[model samples]
Target: MDKIIRIGTRSSKLALWQANTVAEQLGHFGHKTEIVKIDSIGDIVLDKPLYELGITGVFTKNLDIALLNGEIDIAVHSFKDVPTKLPEGIVQAAVLKRGDFNDVLVIKEDENFFTKDAAIIATGSLRRKAQWLYRYPHHTITGLRGNVITRLQKLEDNDWDGAIFAAAGLKRLKLLPEKEKHIKLDWMIPAPAQGAVMIAALEKDEDILEACKEINHEETATCVGIERDFLRVLEGGCTAPIGALAMIFDEEIKFKGTLFSPDGKNKMEFYKEVPVNNATDLGEYGANYILERGGKKLMREVHDIEKSTLVYSTKSLSHDQTNNLSSKIGVTSSDFITIRNNRLKRVIVKKPIKNALFTSQNAVEALLNNFSRVELDFENIYCVGRRTKRLIEKKIGKVTHIENNSEKLADYLVKNLDTKEVTFFCGDKRMDDLPTTLLNNYFIVNEVECYQTQLTPRLIEDKYKGILFYSPSGVESYLKENTANEIVAFCIGETTAKKAKDHFKNVVVSKLSTVESVIKSVNDYFQE
Candidate 1:
């Protein structure tokens, strides 16, 4: 084919490097190429983590659309980002020569942090986070997103001890330091197709397909195929932390795979080998082995964890603000009603408040504002959410049993707590079910209000395509000034969604109940 092939690619530095490299390879075979730079939704939205976006091909979807629409002849992408199931009419044309598959820890020039319990590691990938946490349970993992260069910059600018990055990406961009500033994390199993570049084109475009086939690396393609098959068979979508690596050596195929819990406390791993002739069945067999060895249960737990973490905020958030908040939380968003806290003049604890329970940061903030260490006495502090824990830590310098919700914290207390009595510092609008549930379980509960939530309904004269609600009161507040008959309502969780369904015709509930999840719900609905 003498016609010039158009290669669609992301405009990121790493993406451009991959595209240009592919174009140069194609040029070697006497095929003329044109590089077409395009921006993907994943690139445009930097506020949320990739998995929380709740889309499979967040990075490749734009290129897939371009290929289908004839805007480009072929699309170049990092194979790991491409969904196993390609969009209709598009298929993988070529798998380029594989590169370094190991993840690398890029640390600051002066920092010597490694495997330290007190060190913080920043990485946007769930696979990296789960594995790292599983190995170093004491180390903290925070979210870091952006292109390779931006991520590197973030590592330098932020106070984090280190950040995780792909070895292939750094090598491709020539960003790897000459010194020993980066350490290869060989302990981690690479995500499927991690170090390979995939070229995709219309399945029916025989000319382009034939041209691409000439440049395809058969060995890399075979190994990645096996790895992807394992991924598909396990059904480990973006929501779960999964890793797979396949290699060919001495005319035989070797595979290693792993599935991890969200918190990284539990995991299942598999290692297998087979003759070259039996490579086609290796992935399925390995997946079956893992599934039999508790992978099935791990997958279910991951799904449950993804759905159970709810972010129920009382503040009204716009879409952009919601996205920004989700980025900060390193997850999704779910906002609800408005909150108003009382100014505590003093926290007068006449007697000892044995075990103190806090439901929200508002209560902790109120307490800290009113009382110094001398004014309060408590044996231990337990809180519901991250915000509450941070606030309590700021004042009391310690917190325990930090759960995502009141129910989970209550369950934890009932199962292991030795304390006979507890004092709950909460808001005026706090629900009574948590205390009642504890009371029925034989634990003495004393409740004190430190803050209040006021429902302030604004006149939404302009109709919106969707309304986001984080709490039951938020739903009520939203409905006080508007109708939900024609609009879609995105709720944070089952409870909030249940309340939203009472008035809205079309309701979508975020499984994770985070602001990012709510925004993802909105995008998912509109994109559908």
Candidate 2:
């Protein structure tokens, strides 16, 4: 005599597909299965916006109630739709394998679609609305509520130019018409946990839970766990217009995240990949990295503007200094401060400077502050990367040359420099590559100690499942004073990877030098 497992799901075509998928998996374990379709608040209420409802559980409330009342044994939910905090007596039993997590743009084939201004799009989510508005505010987004079939039908009926939907949903339903193509990752990011199904069960149902475990996909579970953790830390809801998607492929896990203003006029995105072994810490680490880098300030400004027009600008000053300057100039500026305090130097210049090279904006700002009085009639100015080039151009009017990295800059100087005389303006603690490489080419490159970047004495006091290191300096600083309690280390670039190996031998190096690569590496490490 086997127990019958009642799978609860929303009464939508897509939800049925998810429910059926779960039931089929359970059936393999010799369990009798049945599906109980229930309508959620999100399904019934069509008139009002999600934010105005002021209630939290529009997507899960109905199914949850049914689960608690014993009408259903388990509830199948789109992982993204589930709230961070679970209700009493319910726990996430398992997560099935994830599908394509990218958002797809279904554009109608019409000659008039070439212009961006007159395009009309359809979407049901505020998250989608915010992102779309951020990127294409001129293109209007009409609310299209219904399951996948109904929404697509409305799009065809109204002759709406296009609609944005989760790639996973369309693929799961097998309803992507031949006329449309899947959107590329460069176009849009998907909702957090968008592709995965979360199985919710009564806390006491150990037997059914054990049976449900057979369907659980370890890689999908790990990646979604990290993505959900990011959403939790951001304090974002379905209406926040924040999107995050994680993928575990090869030996790495990649996380792509975005934040959009409420009206969708402004948006900031970040990507990180690390070994799968560090997937547990990927979300928090990735979120923190984005916040520390620039996303936090962008998010704050977006949140502050609400419906007002936003003007974005960048000035060389500390947050306090910027505030003082803005106040003096009769402009109300939102604090768009990043980790400025950690990575800049204060100095006074006395001698005439000849050659200057900048790797980071912080380095450029610090150099500018020192030479504010002196006219920099340099032989040549070398800048690393596009960001440093912009900073240099803003302050110095123009730059002599730009290279992709410090290594490339060194290579350029080695090939072209006939006279072995160049001074490098740099941080107090910097990589030896630029100097060492130049020296190998018989060029005299003086390394000036401009500023020092040190880690905070108090590291974030959370029990992270893994740790991420962006730079060799960060790794050295972190390891010099503090212990990470046996957390797996995910390193960004080669330098950071070397530093991690020096301390923790089993360091995970990202396939790419970017943040997205580090996140992907973390995903793959954990899945293994």
Candidate 3:
């Protein structure tokens, strides 16, 4: 405490503000602090985006090196810029209380960009770029790389309609424009520990570490810990397009995370909340939730975007499935629907049930994912599709009945089902025909939503020779960002083919209702 703590920070005004704030906080504890300015690779490279630099902790590495050499007792950094894993011999000393984590849009013109068909928005961060595009797919995004002031100046010199920035930075430096000129993007999730400042110290330096702990905010630390854990589990580091934010309230912690492809074409996201005691691994669990559903494959696509593909699957496929296709037809895939088991766990039945129904494989997987086959048993399993029935038989039990579509399934259930009560496992966006029919037939339909399906529409930059759609939802998700009237539409069944016919000039339905059939149909069409 008696030694003067040397605080290393980037030379940018925003970083200096962080350092001076740290120095002021340390001063109150009777620890003398000296500000040592440092230049980071991020500051030196103004022409390239941070992700393009291909370096981890570009803004904090220089200061970290200074700390490692004992030139500075502690290194200050915008917590988001710090890698989830610290450098060797470096440990986090403190995390100050977080500031405004909302991203703000500084508009050079009016606020009509959202309604317009096309408008130019600028930002250097890939996370921001992707989120903006996901919301405004019709709008144009341009790159602007520099420090806060420099980026603002570039906006002034350019013809962009608006640019994005962290509200904490503009508010900390009192550079936030008037309310009319700027709007808060409340929907945008901030980077991990975005508005917080971090103090890094040598693990052996007990004095500095001890002194810094006095300024550590435990609540901020917990929230940022969750956010950073989510980021680390995603394995994106700083180079990928990822965003995460965590907040605590009323003895409960809430978290939200989003992952995007490198080109910002595809997106995956999850949100969860838990009691304070159960919040420790919530971030890790959330990341795993998406990964199991489809995120792992999407990230692989992001990492290998340079590879060209002639076919794009709205749903992710297994290694064998992709290899099932001829190597001559390169395929790229991502799950357009993010499947989540939020309702699956709570709605699981531990007791034996007479009649159970599944409309899609997603419902079967979602139910089995949270509740094991040993947990519950069903006497009669009636599913709308063969694949769904097969999954039920493989994972849980035998399927007594199977139908091609919901209407047929409803007719079969009404005529054959004698049970007064039936439980239907399905996603959030299921058609109401089966449930309505059962209800009208005086049956107690327990429509337990086993999973929630969210559509993640990604832009398809190039039209392939053909587009393969497994369901009407897949076709709808694809049409959100692309038109395929001229491209061949290979569908798994007549239901999917009917949907494709509305959007495409040519539609081909597989002879069988299966993915293998769809693939073979595609091969046959291209072969001809």
Candidate 4:
């Protein structure tokens, strides 16, 4: 502890501040420290974005090399810049106390600053650049590479009106010049590990690792652990504009994650809070929840953007017009009227049915509307998907069975129940997989067509250069009526793409079966 420990850090002002702070903390423990300033690859590159540089240890690689060579006892870094995968024999020995992990906008003090259009903003991160451009497409973002002071100096010397920086960095260095304002979380999400400092040491250097632990903050470590774990599970890095932040208060932890399209036009945000006792499981649960809802699709699309892919996909169904399919399949003439009138009935029904099966929310809506006055006795309500489950619970009360796919739902009902008299409230042209799967196990399966799906001619003409098809029926409708010149066709899955390929020779099928996979495929195609 008496020997002077060499602390390696970047030569930047911000890195100096971080190193000095750590030195001060270590000094209290009677540990002598010497600072070693080094230049990182990130500091030298000014032409391309960080992600384009292939963001693996651009900042820490040199410091890590110095540490392994015994030139420095510890290497300090902005935890967010550190990669999840580290070089062998090197480890993040301790994470210093976290700071304000939020993105802040620093606009120059000018009379017309708030009203300016197409304001020039400076930023070095692709994640921030993509999100900002998506939100304010009119605003121009120019790359400003340097330490905090240097960037600010560049901002003043150039035509840039503002710049974005991590609030934690400014707060750590006390660099806010009173003219700058901090942006809120609603506007911009901070990068992962944004506000934390990491102490990296040789794996074999137990003395330095143990000494560094005295300064590690437990709450910061736990919260960052959860956030980093979420990032790791998502397989996201600074390159992908994914944002996640965790807040821990007492025994409760709240996590919020956002996935934005590379261009930032389409976005999905997820929020969930769990008790601290379940913190270890929080990352997986949050990830699974996002994937179930739509995060998986968004991620694939983001990756496609990086790979320069164009995506054209849709969720509409395709039908065969020549086969008199409309008549053979049950078609309701007054379907809209039925749905509208039933929605206004404000009636609740209790039917004494042994089993209740649902295909869509419309079924639950119809049952609640028409049979509201009737009392039906059912032990449980089974739904085909999460959306149907939520709808049933909202209208009819809690549902016991929830399945991800329709086929899975059918398999579940067939395996669990012994009764044959099951009532399936569904549409006129609903898929038969669910009923067919359950028919063998039930005495009598009753399917009541509650509504109908009719094609509308309300199509927008040739507005898009590409079309995305999710169902075969959608492809049929587009091919039957609309004629466009050579538009790229993208499908969500193989089943949809097969129908698309029959009509269009230029059909692209997504490798993954989900919506995100389709989007990614489209992006990759377009970019290519």
Model 1 Cα displacement at 292 (Å)? 2.0
lDDT of 3 by residue, 1-528 (tens): 678899999888899999999999999989999999877423242334434432245677678767766778999989988887776677999999999999999999889867878899999888888889888888888988888898999999999999999999999999999989999999988888889989989899988889999999999999999898888777777677788988889999889988887566788999988888778887777776676567866663354333333777777654446657764676666777777775455435867888998888988888877787888778888887678778888889888988877778889888987776898888787743788988899999887877887778888756477788888888888888887857888887776787888889999988767788788887777666
Task: Give the per-residue Cα lDDT of candidate 2 at 159.
Answer: 71
**TM-score for each prediction?**
0.55, 0.54, 0.56, 0.53
- Misplaced by over 4 Å in model 3 are 40-56, 262-265, 300-528
Q: What lDDT would each prediction earn against the true structure?
A: 0.77, 0.68, 0.81, 0.67
Q: Give the local distance difference test score of model 3.
A: 0.81
- For every model shown, the clashing-pair count is 14, 37, 0, 34
**Once superposed on the true structure, which residue ranges of model 2 sit more than 4 Å away at CA?**
40-55, 133-137, 179-186, 292-528
1-528: candidate 2 lDDT, tens digit per residue: 188899999888888999999999888878899898988433343234433432257788788777766888999999988997677668889999887777777766653563656778888888877877776678888898987888888888887888887878888888765644445445666778888899999889999788888889988888788888777666576646678888877989988877776787677677887888756766765565555555555453332323221111111222332232211121121212223323323332344446666766667766665565245656577876566687777777577788755677788877886667787767665663888888887877766555666544334434344566656666666655557556577776565676677678467877655444655665576656
Displacement of the residue 7 alpha carbon in candidate 2, Å: 1.1
lDDT of 1 by residue, 1-528 (tens): 799999999988889999999999999999999999977433243334434532246788678766766888999999998887776667899999999999998877545565344888899988899999998888899999988888989988988988999999999889997557888899999999999999999889999999999999999999999898888777786767889999999988889988998778898888888887768867766776676445767773433233212332335343244444322132222223555666664434766677899876667877766677767887788887665677777678688678766677888888878876888888776653678878989999887787777777655534345677766778887677766667677776665777778888888987564566766776666655
lDDT of 1: 0.77
Model 2: weakest 10-residue lDDT segment is 307-316
Q: Over all chains combined, what TM-score does candidate 3 have?
A: 0.56
Per-residue lDDT over 1-528 for candidate 4, one digit per residue giving the tens place of the 0 to 100 score? 667889999988788989998999999998999998866423342244434532356788778767766778999999988876677777878888898888878766553554767688789877787789777888787887877888778877887677888888777778765743444435676676779998988889888988999998887887877777667656677666677788887689888776676666667676788887668856645554554455656663443222222222233211111112112121111001123212322222334666788866667766665654235456778876566677777667678888755677778777787776677877665543777777665547777666655543334445455676655555655665565457777775554566677767688876644545555565566555
